[model samples]
Target: MAKILVVDDAKFMRMTLKNILTNGEHDVIGEASNGKEAVELYKELAPDLVTMDITMPEMNGMDALNEIVASSDDARVIMCSAMGQQKMVVEAIEQGAKDFIVKPFDEARVLEAVARVLR
Candidate 1:
């Protein structure tokens, strides 16, 4: 089981993700409500994986992803975005996000993405 950090501005999204991951037998090491906090927590926690929201307050996920990757090339981030945010998703991929999950998340998809990245 990989240690994970979940980052999203929405409380429900964060909780839901936590539930899914924990139930899947992965360890959720931390959660953050915004991109800035996500980055800080990533450094402090040094989790094996991160689920990052594309749009967030303070700093955006792309920026955070880039920052994290710059600090640690091995940083594994899976971006979460809405259906219409294709451009942001592409940018996130360019910024070193290992994978992505769409909003209104599907459990299977979420688990698959996490598993793929962890593998």
Candidate 2:
């Protein structure tokens, strides 16, 4: 099982991600309300992976992914996006995100992405 961090501005979204990750047998080590908080938590927790929302207050997923990967070359981040944000998702992948799960995420897809990244 991998240790993970869930980062999203919406409390419900964070809860959803938490449920999914936990059900997948991963330990959610921390939660963050924004990208800035995610970066700090990343430093503190060093989770095996992070599920980061693309749009958030203070900072966005791209910036957060950049920050985390910069600090740890092996940091794994998966961008969570809305339907129309495919371009942003691509940018995130190019920026070092391991994968992405579009919002209102599918449980299987979330698990698949997490598994792929872990492998």
Candidate 3:
């Protein structure tokens, strides 16, 4: 199982993701409420994967993704996006995000994405 860091501004969302990933047999190393914290945690935790929210108060996911990738080229980030954030998703991919999941998350899809990226 891969160690994961979950980044989301909403408490419920972060909890839901933690439950799903843990149930799927992955280790959740850390959780962050904003992109800035996510980046800091990423460095400190050095998790194998990260699930990052696209929109946040301090820093957006795109910026965090870029920074993480810059810090570690092997950084694997899966962006959490809403239905209308296709443009941002594409940009994230271009910025080196491993993959993405739509908000109002699907447990199966989220697990699948995580598994694929980890693999």
Candidate 4:
């Protein structure tokens, strides 16, 4: 099972992702409320994957993705975004995000993205 870090400003969103990941048999090693916390947790936890929300307080997912990728060559990040954030999602992909799940998340899609990224 892959160790995953879930990052989102909303507690409910975080919880949803945690449930999905755990049900899929992946271990959620840590969770962060914002990009800054996400960067710190990533350094400490070194999780196999990260599910990052695009918009958040403090810093955004794109920035966090950049930071994690810079710190680790093999960082695997799946960006989470709202329906109309296609521009941001494209930018995230360019910035090294492995994949993306649009909110509100789909359980199968989330699991599929995680599995694909892990592979």
TM match of model 3 to true structure:
0.98
Which ranges in model 3 have alpha carbons more than 4 Å from their true place?
A: none
| Residue ranges of candidate 2 with Cα displaced over 4 Å | none
User: Candidate 3's residue-wise lDDT over 33-77, tens digit each?
Assistant: 999999999999999999999999899889999999999978999
- TM-scores of the candidates are 0.98, 0.98, 0.98, 0.99
Tens digits of per-residue lDDT for model 2, 1-119: 99999999999999999998889899999999999999999999999999999999999888999999999989999999999999998899999999999999899999999999989
- Give the winner by lDDT: 1 or 2: 2
What lDDT score goes with residue 42 in model 3?
99
Candidate 3 or 1, higher TM-score: 3
Clashing pairs in 2: none
Q: Which ranges in model 4 have alpha carbons more than 4 Å from their true place?
A: none
Candidate 1, poorest ten consecutive residues by summed lDDT: 88-97
lDDT of 1 by residue, 1-119 (tens): 89999999999999999999998999999999998999899999999999999888899888889989998978999999999999989888987899999989899999999999989
TM-score of 4: 0.99
TM-score of 2: 0.98
Pick the winner on lDDT between candidates 2 and 3. 3
List model 4 lDDT by residue over 1-119, tens digit each.
99999999999999999999999999999999999999999999999999999999999888999999999999999999989999999999999999999999999999999999999
The local distance difference test score of model 3 is: 0.95
Which pairs in model 1 have colliding backbones?
none
